[model samples]
Target: MQTTRLPHDGPEISVLALGAASLGSVYSEVSQANADATVQTALGLGVSLIDVAPYYGLTKAETALGLALQGVERSRYTLATKVGRYGDKAWDFSRDATLRSLGESLGRLKCGHVDVLQCHDIEHGDLKQLVDEALPALRELKAQGVIRYVGITGYDLAVLEKIAVEQQVDTVMAYCSFTMQDQRLGPVAQRLKSHDIAVFNASPLGMGLLTRKGPPDWHPGHETVHKAAAEAARICAEAGSDISRLAVQWALQKAAEQGIASTVIGSSSAVNMSDNVAALNVPIDAELLARVEAVLAPVRDLGWDVLPGNGGKAGS
Candidate 1:
C-alpha cells in the first residue's frame, strides 16, 4: 500500500483509506462480526486512515470500530470521526454539543482522543454558527490535544472552497466529485493546496453510481444519470473489464496526479475489501478508460439535486 503525508503538516496516511459507513450499515445491515472482520482486513492491507461519523448507523460504526480495535495499539492507525448532524435531519453544532459529541466519540471508540475531528456535514448546518461557534470549538480541542487535525466535510464544492479560504481548517473532504464521471475536484485542488490544507476525496465509485450494480435505492441520481452509468458499465464489460475496478483505479490515479493525499472507500465484505486494496496495483488501460468515460459523457457533470440548504445532493 502507498502512503502520503497530508499537505499543511497533517499526519501521513495511506493513499487508500478505509471508510467505516458500511460497518454502520448505511445501505444494508452488517453484523458485528462482519464489521470487525472488515476493519481487521483493512488494517491487514496496510490501510492507516479510518473515517467514520456519528451520523453513520447512529453510532453503531464508532462502537463497532472501538470493539474491533479493542486490544490494538492506537499508534497503528489514524482515527477520524465527525461531529455535527446526529441523524438524517438532526443538526447541532453548539459548543456544548460538540464537546459532548467528542466525549461520546472518544468513549465509543474506546480512545482518549481522535487524530482527526471534523465538523460533519457542514452544508446542512447554519453556516454562520458553523464558522462562528463550531470551528472555534474544534480548534480548542486541537489546542487541548484532543485532536491533531481539524477539517470539514461537505458535498458542495463552492461551499468547501469558501471554507478552505475563509476558515482555519487543516484538511477538507469532498465526495462524489473525483470519480470517473466527474473530475470537478481537480479544479479545487490547487486552491486547497494554496491554503496548505490537505485534500481527501471520498466515494470514488460515486456512491455506487459508477459500479455495475448501479446506485442503491437511496442514491439521489436521476434516471438519466443511472442509465448513463449502466451504459458505462456495459462499455467496460464489453472490453472484458469490471466497471467498479476501473472506477477505483481511475480515481486513485487521478488523485495521485492532482496531489490528493488519500481516497476513502467503504465495504463490509472481505472480498470487496481485498479487491479495493488490489485495485491499486492494477495498471490503467487508457483505451478502456477512455471508452468508459465516453460512454458516461452524457451524464458527465450531471449531478443530483441539491436540497436548497441541506448541502447539494451527491455529485453536487
Candidate 2:
C-alpha cells in the first residue's frame, strides 16, 4: 500500500500500480466480473494508479475499467492511458492520430482527462516522428487539460533515454528492462530522474519469463532463457515461495529503493491482486533471492530481440 511521488511536479501514485493488460485478456480471457473485482480490490488495498491502453484487449481493458470505476470517486485514483499502436500491427503517432487516439481512449475509459498520457510502444514506430510530431501533440493536449502529464513508453533503453532526456516529458514507462534479470535501466532511469522525469517500470515479471508457469509462446525470450527462468522459479519454490511473489516484491522494493515512482503489474484475478499486495509485507529473503539469481546466472539479461531502430536483442 506504499506510494511514491512522481518527479518533475507530477502527482503521487502507488508504488504498485495496477496494470490492465490482463483485463484486456492479453494471455487469457478475463470476465467482466473478475475485472471489476480486480480493480476494486486494488483500490481497496490503496493502489491509486491504474494504467491501461486501447491496444490492450483491443479496448476491452479500458471499457472494463470504465465500468468498474463508475460511481467511484474519480479523485480516489490516478488514471493513465496511451496513444499510438491501436492493434498488433497498426501503429500511427502523427499529431492527428495521437489526438484521435486520446479522444477514443477517454471515451473508453470514461474519464475527462488522464493524469498521464504516454506514447505507447514507441519502439515500433519511427523515433524521429515520435520526437518530432507525437510528443508535441501530447504536449498540446497537456496544455489543453486533456492530459495532465506527458510521457512515452518503450522497450529500448537507449531510445527511451534519448526520448526521456530530449522530450523533457513528465515520465517514461519501460517494460521488461528493469527486472531482476536485467537491471539495465538503472543508468537510464538515473538520467531521467536527474531531469525530474519519473520512471514507471512495467512487467517486472519479465513478461511471464520469471514465473513458474514459464514464458508463453508469444514471449520473445529464447528457449535457454526460458529454461533458466524455470530453474529460478524452482529455486524459489524450494524455498517455500512462489516466483511470481518474489518477482513482484523484488521489483516493487527495488523501485522504491531507486526512487522510481511505481512498478506496473497486471492480473485479472482478485486473488492474485491480494496475494501480490500481501507479498509486499513479507521481508525479502536475501539468501533465497541470491539463489534464484544464481539459477538465472547463465541467461542473465539474455532475452530475445524486442528493441526497435536496430532490431537488436535486449538484455544482452
Candidate 3:
C-alpha cells in the first residue's frame, strides 16, 4: 500500500483508507464478528487509517472498531472519527456537546485520543457557530494533546473551502469520483492543496455504483443515481476497462495528479477490498483517461445544475 503524510505530525497513512460506514450496516447488515474480521484484513493489507463516525449505526461502528483494535498497539495505526451529528438528526455544534461527543467517541473507540477528529457533514447554516463554538473546542483538545488534528467533511465544496481558508484544519475529506461526472470539487481540491491541508477523497466509487455488477438500474435507489451509473458503465466499456477498476483507478490517479494525500474506499467484502486495493497497481494510460473524460462529458451536464437543496438527490 502507498502512504501519504498527514499535515499535522507527518504521520504516514495508507493512501487507500478503509471507510467503516459499511461496518455499521448503513448499506447492509453486518455482524460484529464480520466487522472485526474486516478490520483485521485491512490491517493485514497495510491499511493504517480507519474512518468511522458516531452517527454510523448509532455508534455501533465506533464500538466495533474499538473492539477490533483491542490489545493492538496504538502506534500501529491512525484512527479518525467525526462529530457534529448524532443518529441522523439535526446538526449540533455546542462546545459542551462537542466535548462530550469526543469523550463518548474516545470511550467507544477505546483510545485515549484519536489521530484525526473531524466535524461531520457541515453545511451553509450555522457556519459561524462551528467556527466560534465547535472549532475552538477542537483546538483546545488538540492543545491539550487529546487529539492530534482536527478537520471537516461534507459534500458542499463552498463550505469546505470556507473552513479550509479560515479554520486552519490539518485535513479535509471531500466527495470525489469518476462517476461524479461533474468534477465539482476539482478546483476546491487544488485550493486545499495550496493551503497545505491533507485531502481525503471520499466515495471514490460513487457509493458502489461504479463497482457493482451490471448497469445502474440494477440497484433500487434514486433514479438519477442509477442513470449516472449507467452512463459510467458505458464510459468504462468504451475505455475497455472494467467500470469498477476504472472508477477506483480514476480516483487514485486523479488524487495523485492533483496532490491529494489519500482516498477512502468503503468495502463490505474481502473480495471487493482486494479488487479495490489492486486498482492502486493498475497502470492507466493517457488514451484511456481521455476516453473516460469524453464519455462522461454528456452525463456531467445533467448532474451539474441539480444542487443538494433539491431534495438531496444523488448524482448531483
Better of 1 and 3 by lDDT: 1
Ranking by TM-score: 1, 2, 3
lDDT of 1 by residue, 251-301 (tens): 888898887879998777778888898988989888998888887887777
Tens digit of lDDT per residue, candidate 2, span 1-316? 8777776466678899899988988868889999999999999999999999988888898999999898889889999899887887677888889988888888888878788998888888878778888999988887887778898898877888887787788989998877878777767777788788888998888877787777655676667777778888888888888999989888887786676788888788899899989999999888889888888777766645532222222220
- Off-target runs (Cα >4 Å) in candidate 3 are 177-180, 213-225, 234-241, 285-292, 301-316
Q: Tens-digit lDDT track for model 3 on 73-115?
A: 8888998888887855457888888899999999999988798
Looking at model 1, residue 35 earns an lDDT score of 84
- What is the model-wide C-alpha lDDT for candidate 1? 0.84
Residue 85, model 1, lDDT:
78
* Model 1 worst lDDT run, 10 consecutive residues: 307-316
lDDT of each: 0.84, 0.82, 0.75
Task: After the best TM-score superposition of candidate 3, give how far the Cα of residue 279 lies from its true spot, in angstroms.
Answer: 1.6
TM-score of each: 0.94, 0.94, 0.88
Supply candidate 1's per-residue lDDT for 263: 93
Model 3: ten consecutive residues of lowest lDDT: 307-316
